[model samples]
Every structure is written in C-alpha cells, then in structure tokens.
Target: MSETLGRRGFLSAGIAAAISAQFAATHNEARAIEPIERNGQAKFKYSLAAYSYRGLLQGKAAELTMHDFVSDCARMGLEGTELTSYYFPADVTPEYLRDLKRHCFRLGLDVSGTAVGNDFGHADPQKLREQIEHVKHWVDNAAILGAPVIRIFAGHVPKGGSADDTHRQMVAAIDECC
Candidate 1:
C-alpha cells in the first residue's frame, strides 16, 4: 500500500517541507541579532540616497512617481531618502512640498538630500543668472524638504570655448552661488 502511494507525492511533500524549513531557519537567524546598543542605550541610524534608484527613473522610462519611489524605499527598510529634481512635477507648489514631507513621515522615511541639474557657466550673464536663480530655488526647496545637502552641476562648455575658460567660468559661477 505504501509503495502504491507513489513516489511523486512524497517527493513534492519533502521538497515543500525542506523549503519551509529553510525559510524558518533564515527567519530565526535574522531574529538572533541582539539590538544595537551603546552603554546600555539603543541607537538609531538612517541612510538613503536618490542615486540608488536612478536606474528606475531614467529619462522617459520612469513609470513610478516621486511618491511611489519613496514608498518603495520605505518598503526596502530604508529610513531616509534623497530626491532628484527630475522627479518633481513642473508645477510644484508649497502645499505639495509639505504634503510630500508629511507622506515621508507617515512612512517613517526622512528626506536626507536633494539633487538639481542646473548649470551656471554660460557666457551670457543673463543665462548665468537664470541658472543661478534656478539652483537657488532648488536649494530653498531642499531646505523645505528637510534635506541637508543639495547637489548642483557645472554647466557644459560651448564648442567654441576652451577648457581653461570653461573651468574659470564654472569656478566663477560657483562663487556667485556662494
């Protein structure tokens, strides 16, 4: 009668049990770590960055909104986040920014930093000023979002401009920002 029960059912049951046992063992191993403590006090730490998800937000390819990206980070056990400027909609308002912050808090995520792509090395003063103004706005938004760092980029040199001139212009633009 035992032999007639067939080998397939027994093999399937054995495999399922083995998989379940492996999962349980892994869970137990994870739970075995003692809570981090210093001098009998538990310490909390957080880290996250926008660049970590750049691949998911590539040009014209991103399917997820900024909020969704943040949520995904939270799901991954991250306690902090950095936002890229491209993720923001064109008509971002103060209320919208506040809502974003509130959403992060609800998800237990902190806004650690912001990244902007403005470049201020143009030869035309007006263009340079415009870029600077754009970057300043981004910095303000970063502050509003509770970001400690705001990344900016140096503008690319025109084809006719020498590398040395471009470097000088970039340095001047950075000085202007300061």
Candidate 2:
C-alpha cells in the first residue's frame, strides 16, 4: 500500500522535522526531540533532507547520487527523507522515479517531500504560463514518486516590477500549478 501523505499533512511533518534536525545539530545533543503526544502516542517524526548533501552531489565534496543520500539517511537512522528536485537529471523518466521510490521503500524511509526552484515574477504572460507548466510537471512527478508535498518558491521580483504585482502574478501561477 502507498504510504503517501496529503500535502498539508506532509508539510507539517516536514517542517517540524527540519526544525528538530536544525536544533539537534546546533546544540550537539542526542535525538532529544520531544514528540507531540496524542492519546499517549508520538505524533512527529524526524527526517533528513537530500539537499544537505548538495555539495557532495554537485561535485564540490564527494561523489553521490540521490540513492546514496537515501542510504546515508538510513545509516543515520532518520525516519524520512526529502528528495530535493535540484539534484535530479534533466531528463528524468518515470522509470527513474519508480526506482527511486522503490529504493526509499526498501530502506524504510518516507518520501517526505520534494522542492523546485521557480520564478513566477515574469511580466510576460507566456513566460508565466511556461513557468507554471514547468512546476505542474514536477507536481506530477512528485505524485508518481509517492511524495506528498512539493515546495515551490517565487523568485526575486523582476527589475522595476512592483511587489504587489509580482505577488499577484505569483498567486496566479501557483493557482495554475495546483
């Protein structure tokens, strides 16, 4: 059975996990994150983001792939992992996505989420539409990979464009992406 969470639920889990990881790292403490108890059961989980291995994957440190990142997280005993989209090859196919998901499943890790870099501040309607389409494509891939949340960001405002206008454009682009 697929264990994918809904977007909102996954966002909540991913954010809490990220904050917990940061706190633990900076404080040099054990995994002391207190779980949110509900009916005497823990509600939150801890995860490692693949982006944390960016330098290694991008050739700045050591050679690695997303699969290696998953293995490292499993070795570190994380409960979930965020598969950052930046490290994926440009021509990623459905077969590749299926393999990735299967690998995570075999390692007993949740595909916490994925992320994309986008600019929705373009003044040109065509450009904005293209950007939305690009994001939508990733959304489909995320679903296929059993990932619940796909984080997207509105880039810096275009030169001379008003913040209000950019904000509206971003909203429109997001709406279309959804």
Candidate 3:
C-alpha cells in the first residue's frame, strides 16, 4: 500500500510539472507579441470592429464608452477600428464625432469606418424613407469621423411580399442616401 501511494504521488507531481511548463511556455509566446514602440511608431497594426467586443460590453464585464473602446483598440496593437452606432451615447453629433476623431488621433488609431444599423426593406414608403434618413445620418457622422466607408444592411424580405418590390424599395433607399 505504501509503495502504491508513493507511485501515485509521483505521477501526480509529474503531471502537475508538465502542465506548469506548458502554461509558462504559452505565456511567454503571448508576451513575445508585445507591442514595440520605436521613434514613436508601433511595429504592428491591426483593426478592431466594435462588434467583436459586444459580448464584453453587454455582459457588463467592461463599461466602455466610444473613447474608451478606441483606447482599448490602441492598447491591443490595433491601428484602426470600425465604430458601431450602438456604442455611441446618443445620436451622432458633430461635436461628438469630432471628439471621437480626436481621441482616435491621440491614441494613434484611425476610424476606418462606421457600421450603421438600418433596415430599409419596409413595405411602407414612409418607413423606408425614415430608414434612409437614418442611414444618411450615420453616413454623415462617418464622414465627420473621417471614415471612408459606411456599412449598411438590407432588411429582411417580409413574408407574402413580392421579391421585386423589396428589391425596388432597397434600391430607392440607396438612391435617397446617395
């Protein structure tokens, strides 16, 4: 019994040591990718989409404002970001857009674009027009933030509706925004 216990303990210690060594190796590998700053320049550049971190934000793991999100992007070695309208405190204002641009500039991260959530496939002309206006509003905000692209979505096709009609409505909305 004593010999069996000693063998089991030795095996357990060996397994623990192997796991610890693997953990240390993995940690060191991650650290090797650490951002480097030389002559006020970073060695690597990447882009982050706000949607990528939505789980953290909505889960309350992190209370991140737009500015804070941009800073986080910089810290993660990202040089660009795609801003989501949901993260903004309110309707995009010129002042707020300016501030966001400034914050990104200070952090050395560029606002690559804005993701505007607008569904413009409504059957009602009035509703479609409203959604178009919403898209244009975000496009304007994107322009203010020096974003080159504005991501837009085509709303779902309603059941029992003509596919042609839905396509026409989407085209009209696109024209209106343009």
- Name the candidate that leads on TM-score: 2
For model 2, residues 122-144, the per-residue Cα lDDT tens digits are 88889888888889999999998
Q: Write the per-residue lDDT of candidate 3 for residues 58-106, one digit (tens) a residue.
A: 4445676778788899988888999987677655579988998999998
| CA lDDT of every candidate | 0.81, 0.86, 0.84
Report the alpha-carbon TM-score of model 1 versus the true structure: 0.66
lDDT of 1 by residue, 35-107 (tens): 6667765657565666666777656768777788889889989878888886787778778888888889899
TM-score of 2: 0.74
Q: For each candidate, give its TM-score against the true structure.
A: 0.66, 0.74, 0.70
Q: Residue 126, candidate 3: how far off, in angstroms?
A: 2.2
Q: Which scores greater on TM-score, model 2 or model 3?
A: 2
Error of 2 at 54 (Å): 1.0
How displaced is residue 156 in candidate 3, in Å? 1.2
* Candidate 3 local Cα displacement, residue 57, angstroms: 4.0
Stretch of 10 with least lDDT, candidate 3? 55-64
Off by over 4 Å in 1: 1-48, 51-62
| Model 3 vs. true fold: TM | 0.70
Worst 10 residues of 1 by lDDT: 41-50
